[model samples]
Target: MSTLVQLVLAMLTGGAFSTIVHAVMNRRRSNAEAAQIIAEAAASLVGPLNERLGQHEQRIQVLEAENAHKTTLLDEAIGFIRDLLAWAGRLLPGERTPDIPDTLRDELQL
Candidate 1:
């Protein structure tokens, strides 16, 4: 009877140990799988994300170039209008409009 009890106790202890080890192994495998899935997902996103970023960079460059061109044209238009204003001021009867400021002349290279 004592031997029988000891046998049963041994079996229970072995089963418990095996269960704990199995649980630990399963948890490790799950963690590894989760990490792999996340890595794969990030890897999948990299290509499209980089492509979109490149496209945005190109669009930004185009917009910057257009802005620069428009700014140049606007500056020229402003210079022309200033010159016209100076010419018109000379013909007017009232006090002559002040000459273009030296700063504006220097900036416009007029």
Candidate 2:
């Protein structure tokens, strides 16, 4: 009787231990699966966002280059206008007083 009781108790203890182990393993598996799902979602988002960022950077570079070109042209135009005005000023006779309108002189600072 004592030997039979000992065997039954041993069997019960082994079953309980196995159940606990199975529960722990199942929990770990679920946690790992959740982590994998989150990682995959983040990875999926990375590709499209990276592509968009690259496109935006390229656009900004293009706009900056265009702005630089326009600024250079504007500077050249201003210089050309200044040169023409200086040439005109030099051609006019210095001693002879030209008829200058008061408003025009004030506006042009002549």
On TM-score, the leading prediction is 2
TM-score of candidate 2 on Cα atoms, chains taken together: 0.68
Candidate 2 segments whose C-alpha is farther than 4 A from its true place: 1-12, 93-110
Quote the lDDT for 14 in model 2: 66
Give the CA lDDT, 0 to 100, for residue 35 in model 2. 100
- Each prediction's whole-model lDDT (CA): 0.78, 0.73
Q: What TM-score would every model get versus the actual structure?
A: 0.63, 0.68
Per-residue lDDT of 1-110 in model 1, one digit per residue for the tens? 24465456558786675556666767999999999999999989998999999999999999999999999998888888777776776778486665777767765543
State each model's C-alpha RMSD to the native: 8.7, 9.0
lDDT of 2: 0.73
Error of 2 at 37 (Å): 0.6
TM-score of 1: 0.63
lDDT of 1 at 88: 75
Weakest ten-residue segment in model 1 by summed lDDT = 1-10
What lDDT score is found at residue 107 in candidate 1? 59
